[model samples]
Target: MNLILKLIAGIVAGILVGLYVPLTGVELLYTVKEIIGQLLTFTIPLIILFFIASGIAGLPKGSNHLLGKTVGFAYGSTIIAGTLAFMLVSAIIPLFDGGLTFNAEVATPLSNLINLKIPPLMDVMTALASAFIFGIGISQLQLETLKKVSDQGRDIIDALLAKVIIPALPFYIAGVFAEMTVAGTVFETLQTFGVVLVAALVMHWLWLSVLYISTGVLLKRNPIELIKNMLPAYFTALGTMSSAATIPISLRASKANDVQEDVANFSVPLCATIHLSGSTITIVTCAMAVMFLSPSMDVPSLVDMLPFIMMLGVVMIAAPGAPGGAVMSALGLLTSMLGFNDSAVALMIALYLAQDSFGTACNVTGDGVIALWVDRFSKKAGS
Candidate 1:
């Protein structure tokens, strides 16, 4: 049973249940969604703290300088991907502007079956801060013990993914869509943002092509061959909708393309955190669609978005490489800076989740391209 297929099954099953199955007296099903969302929330801070810290810390001290160049290229590509999606979605959305409204029903909050308390790491700033502190600190000191500890921290998260989260995703996804169906927001969101989604997928591919085509030319490797070899990673990301989850697949693909193990190791994990080309595309496009639909808000001009997109490009560096991570990163900005109401934020969530897989596919595939460029630069310097 392919994991992707199983997840797809969960999505389909959930939609069927949400639409056809009676929601009467089905409190347990609703709880399933809540727990999974909580688990994802729990997973984000730890993964960010550990994955970033360990990834940066693991690099050799002299090699640490490469971080600057790597981040530059990664951020540059992410902005390009976001801008492309923003332009394409902006152009296409007016055609679908039949003025769809989100008629979300008021729903009761589900009560917890059991009271359980975990101390919160709710501050993303704290996570980002700790990641940089521990990562840079360990790199400078080269503390073997601390490296081992950080590795263990990442291992613990992996256990959570394999044992708890991964196995539970189908149910989680089903529960999510099912809840959306009950709330009556999913279909309407889809109706309005379908064009945005198509635009996002198209941009995801275009940006990926831009990356590989450039790297392919630089390395003198056939770009088509590079892309063909990465199909496994792409499909894996598409199914998982998570760059962190697809790291192994992306690394494997990079190695197959002759990326040095050191580069692949350092690049893939770091890229998972910072290389969010696909996710940004979806976020920008979805945010624009939500604003346009809401009537009170109009989408910002590209000039207005310059600073915001620059900030978004940086903020995404701290974004967890998990499903829905990009939107969560954008949530604060959209609400505070962009004046999005609760309804608009909710629409953004639904819209981003709906197209999360494609964005993730774009993200993980792009990781391989970055690895190629990094690998080439490393060899050039070594020579």
Candidate 2:
């Protein structure tokens, strides 16, 4: 909540500065944006590598059946949510403004005062491949030593995110807006993004309704009652802005839905880590908006976006436990798959962080659905 407030403050301050400040001041702001952008880019691969590797290696070896079912459900849910967002946003977003497009003519251009670049140790794909190879090998071979290393590496990256990246985000965003304001596009940008944010929130609830209704029909349960049971978890997650932090309430809610205790215990925690359908929806929606708004980028067709959504489900594994962690996990994909530039990525981070609490609430609530399904399947296998 503090982070969101701080981000709002940053946006307001940047806009004020851009309105009143001289060119040098705006240039200074752009410099800050540039440096922070470099640091964020450098961290993206490491976040993907360590987090995914540690998550995979840390899985409980004995619960293969439960784990496989849970992961499959989580991934399928995420992909479907992303796809749905892409289709809906593609159709509906155009109706909002008859399609918003950036006009580069009136834009005042600002450049970084200092040209600095920090490259990643490995590219996103390389980091992803290496993480999978080492993670699977460590898990299969019982390589405790490498597993410990991956865990430590994950901890290190988590710290950097919590301490550095999260804190720096407001200023990065402020700079982004300041540059836009100077270009005379900030007000239009804000108007369009306000619509985008509302659309994203609507999509979150829409997807949640889809999940519970599908689960209700399949399990022959009242979807409303199930949603009612999960409301406490949803509100808790909105406050905490964290799926992991809301797991306790989520477990209680799942159990209240008559999910078996053991399944709730296993699936709630695992879903907290892997089931990011809500976050995926927001990312896809925001990514599409960014593409539509950017002159340098083009909106992708559903076919072009499917592969990104598939890889996004994998990249989102064990996202760092911090505010905006899902977007942090997804930055690489936005850049690599969608060709998001620095400004596009910054807009994405800002737009995502603004409504992050809602997304987390959605994620936590949806975990109960996975728990119910997993419980039913586990019992069937036992019978």
Candidate 3:
């Protein structure tokens, strides 16, 4: 009940702020939104790193197969799902007549998508180091020695995030919407391309549902029952728009859907960290739209851009932690690899924010379905 109330309050507050922003002016909205965006940007990497490293470290040694299979399936499905989404959008967008062309003022250099500037080797080493530290730290602590203390840490983090951090989100969202609204940007920005945007979002949702259904069929599980069982988690994801935040509810839903407890416990945390179907789709769709819109560049043939699109998908998987990480990464790929301009990147960011919630819901739903499939497969192998 409390969760429901909080969600309702957040929505109502967000709408009110979005509506009020134009009346107030763009400067205030931009300032407020930028501040909030910066804070979120800062928190994202730390939270993701700790959450992933600790979770991986904490997994019991014997649980590697379950973990490995679950992660592998998630990554594979996300890549396939992203590619299918891109093809669907590519085919559908051309029907919208001249279809979302970009203004010349914003064009900049496109980056190479395949040759990512990998993070420093030290950062990778740090992640591994942190994982070991966390794993060993937990393993050494006797359950009786730290049970209550452990619970305290969990409770504190939960309270801080839920009570303090989350309530502020609507304000931030309002500020962003307001800035866009006041700039007379909403219609001009989305103008003529609303259909394409809608089509892309729908395709994302459809592909996610397809992934779930395919997994169900493969596992001999009832697809409708799978959807029904995951409703609480789905709704939670819809409201929160953060897969990391939705992990607990997703785990609960997986258990309800008959996933084994050990599998649920291991897979949900990993999925929350790395499973990003929604983000991947948003990045690709937005990037493509921007490319089509840009007036300066000779639009690359779809066949020509296929390699870059696939590379963008992989880069975005590692992007959840960076501020504007996904969009920046996509933009970098476009400019450095594909020769797209900066205007395209800006437009991509603007368009993507509009449909981010839908993308997040798709991501969480796919995670639940994958967890079920992994559990079923493991059971079969054991038998």
TM-score top scorer: 2
TM-score of 3: 0.64
TM-score of each: 0.70, 0.97, 0.64
Displacement of the residue 335 alpha carbon in candidate 2, Å: 0.7
Instruction: Give one digit per residue, the lDDT tens place, for model 3 in 1-383.
Output: 33334433533453455456444344454455555554443333343334333444344566768867877887777677767766876776676536454453422121222332323223322433453455447655634344344334434434544555445555554444444444344344446447556866777768867876787788788888988888888788777767777889999999998888988988887776667777777776766665555555555666776676665544444344312334533544555566653334334554555566677777788888778878878898892
lDDT of 2 at 357: 97
- Candidate 3's C-alpha runs over 4 A off are 1-61, 107-188, 298-306, 321-331
- Models ranked on TM-score: 2, 1, 3
- Local accuracy of candidate 2 as per-residue lDDT tens digits, 74-177: 89999999999999988987775445654323355787799999989999999999999999999999999999999999999999999998999999989988
| Cα lDDT of model 1 by residue, 247-334, tens digit | 8899899999998898888888778878888888888877777666655676788887766677678667545444666776666567
Estimate the Cα RMSD of every predicted model relative to the unseen true structure. 5.1, 1.6, 8.6
Q: Which candidate, 2 or 3, has the higher TM-score?
A: 2
Q: Report lDDT (CA) for all predictions.
A: 0.72, 0.89, 0.59
Tell me the lDDT of candidate 3: 0.59
- Candidate 2: stretches off by over 4 Å: 97-108
